[model samples]
Target: MIPQIRSRVLWIVMSGLVLLLASVHLMIGGLDQHEEKSQRLRFLPDGHFLRTASLGYRELTADVLWLQAIQVMGERKVSPEAGRWIYRLLDVVTTIDPKFTWAYEAGGIALCTLVVLPEESNRLLEKGMLHNPEEWKFPFLLSINYAFELGEDAKAAEAMALAAQLPGAPSNLGRLAANFFVSAKAPQQAIDLLSDLYEKTSDPGTKSLLGERLKRVAVERDLQLIEGSIARYRQSHGGLPSRLEDLTTSGILEKLPIEPYGGRYEYDPHSGTVRSSEISERMTLSMKRRRDSL
Candidate 1:
């Protein structure tokens, strides 16, 4: 019985070795053209096959495929069609070895920057995040992909928050995430993230800093709501209100949102804009971006 099992193992090993060699040639057939590459991909074993059919040789097969995938991308110009093939190759590699961290990073950057394939990059990085939950780079990359390529700031902030919570993540990641959340127009999300971070962090300095930023964000949020109400009032009444409370009296706000920093809301009747006396405009993201030369 042992001999029979050994023979079966040998057979599976030999078959896997042969298939691995055949699969390497798959990249040679079509890189310059999408249609041809797509056709050749049909012959290559898919992710499921690599995962389930490798006969315990999945790691070896995965390594070989990873090399081929890298080589294909390095040797070719990475046209749109080639990008798709690269995505497939990477998918197969990651499927075979879910813990392959470098594969995810390489694929994430290459797919996003080399071609207009943010969706593919996002999928690969998200899978990396799923498999390697402790690794911060995957979600960091996802945050970047969502922010710059996809223009989804809320998702970007969420991804950055995930990255920030992991060990070895940059300490400023949470701060960056707050900006993204605010830019996403989701001030509550920013408040929530900062609140959570402030609670978990034991460093008093960090907590104090986060407290200040949290109050500032809260102030910004309330001001944004009040500004919107002011706009509506202007449209209906054709002029600015004399005071912030007028909005509440006019049924625009149930009541003015309290400023978190114990400062009153400043209603500029001339411009019809609301500001928080506690949080300076320079402290807000827009002013920061401008100061930073955005």
Candidate 2:
């Protein structure tokens, strides 16, 4: 009986010890997993910190070192290389605080000025859009790039249209699009687009500018059509018209389209010239003044 009781006690103690050891092992495994996830979330994916460490500065934290590196790169103006550095820094900063608006703005501007390649700048803007697609400025930057730098009016128009669809985009963007279309030489389309914008907007400055642009586009379109008609008439009749009336009489034009800025089109019979009403004598005076100053 005494031997059986001792054996039972020993069995119970050993079982308790085995259960405690198993619990401790599971707890250690869980802690290790949590530590790994925390480490992964703390750093950016690009190995910038790893590179920094490889460069032999072990004392500073990764975030501070990254900021210092970005500032140095910015001061040097090395362009695309600087752009790459800034992008890496921004990635870390954004990962730290996804809602940081200023970081996005600064990152976008840095990408714009330093990248030197429109496609890369565009990719940066797209990344910003992923964070804040409803913001007006990202798409606006894309539109400006397409319109002014790339001279891709169709792409510019598409970007501007997307910007306009956003909640807070400036109303003037519509007028800008119309002007871009006109500058791209699609005047009728420009006229149609601006006419709609003019009706929608009531701001005095915007209205006046759109109205003027619309009139100018219409006049230029008419001038081109008339010029073509005049050329065809000359080909058929072997000479140019002596006056605006001659064109109407010969069925080359029904009536001369008056110049938009308040004057009749002037025709010089001797030189076969058509003069616009708003000729600036200022150019001659400006030249004289510059000569006098020199």
- Tens-digit lDDT track for model 1 on 1-294? 999999998987788677665655554444435546556456556778667766677787787787777665565356777788778888988998899877887787677544557789899999998999999877976876676556678898999989999988767788878888875555565567557656765744335545655665577578778888988988989888889888989998899887786778887788776777854442234323544785
lDDT of 1: 0.72
Residue pairs with backbone atoms closer than 3 Å in model 2 (clashes): none
Top TM-score hit: 1
lDDT of each: 0.72, 0.55
| Cα lDDT of model 2 by residue, 14-88, tens digit | 665455334433432243346542232233344443334323322223345344434533453444544565566
Least accurate stretch of 10 residues (summed lDDT) in model 1?
A: 279-288
Q: lDDT score of model 2?
A: 0.55
Q: List the candidates' TM-scores in order.
A: 0.57, 0.40
